[model samples]
Target: MTKQHIGILALLVIILPSCSYFDFSPDLRFCDDFYVVVEEMPVLIGGMAELQQKVVYPELARERGIEGRVTVQFIVNKLGDPTEVQMVRGIGGGADQEAVRVVKQAKFEPGKQNGKPVCVQYQLSINFRLEN
Candidate 1:
């Protein structure tokens, strides 16, 4: 083959791979999904101090003298509201219930990923201490 023809063939070979790699099929569509943002945290009713005061000592914990920390997972909605409360860790008896009660009553400022309000999961730790 002529040197010119050979050079043209070599160029085509190098360019072919890149063309295939960059090709986007006309029938295909790509979409990116994103989450909403929360503007502010929800306000807790009576605040954290009031929540602690309202928390009742678990009867089971009192009976068994159990003392430890319980972790609760919940979601703060866009409106700074909490919901879907569940115990990630339990301290047994009334302690669990007390933790749930306090968490439910506690309000968050809401979390945002972007600029819009979105539901975000949060974890809270409740510690029960036995007084001497």
Candidate 2:
């Protein structure tokens, strides 16, 4: 084959793999990763106060006076369901698990990317304070 033909074939091999046509491959870069930021971020339907109300303060935590903030990280999917819920910061005393549970039960208005719903990584902090 001519050198020109060989060069073209090599170039195509390098570029084609990155094209959308080959997105089905197992390459992580081609995967539809959850966006950290989007054109529109997901919103909790009833606002933060509503979410805080849903939280049932852990009895163990209250007994121990474990009062602080628990931060949770989760993925808000295209369907507005919270998935992959996890605690990013915790004060222990069952607070971590409680935080995760509350976040898991919560639903959001799915984030938008280019005006279309998409999965987005979201973080929220819930404060735990004792009544004075």
Candidate 3:
């Protein structure tokens, strides 16, 4: 192909990925079908401290002396609500459930792509430890 044609093709390649052809739909069928990264990732509304305050140490876990981190994966939607929370890593003894509970109750500032709110996959780890 001519240099002019090649140049035009290269320009299209650069522009197409950011175009409406990849439009986001809030009604997407699959929960995993969300952006992993965006121009601005979602932030917890009151930050991690606010979410940590919501955690209730499970009696069984506390009694058993189970202490570790529970990692949760979820999608922060355009509305800044977490959905589809799943445990990525868990230290049993009810810590998994507690982690999920707190995450579901948390709110966030929606992630942005091209200055528009978009769904983004996010991961957070909550630590459980016995206080002296």
TM-scores for the candidates: 0.60, 0.75, 0.76
| Model 3 lDDT per residue over 23-75, tens place | 64456323445799899999999989889989999999999999999999999
How accurate locally, in lDDT, is each candidate? 0.69, 0.87, 0.90
Q: Candidate 3: worst 10 consecutive residues by lDDT?
A: 24-33
Q: Which 10 consecutive residues of model 2 have the lowest summed lDDT?
A: 23-32
lDDT of each residue in 1-132, candidate 1, tens digit only: 999999999998889767967664431111123123235433455666666676677777878889998888777765566677899998787888789888877766656555655566667788887777
Q: How many clashing residue pairs appear in each of the predictions shown?
A: 9, 0, 0
What stretches of model 1 exceed 4 Å from their correct place?
Answer: 1-50
lDDT of 2 at 60: 95
The per-prediction CA RMSD against the true structure, in angstroms, equals 12.6, 6.8, 9.6
Error of 1 at 66 (Å): 0.6
lDDT of 2 at 47: 90
lDDT of 2 by residue, 44-88 (tens): 988999999988888999999999999999888888888888999
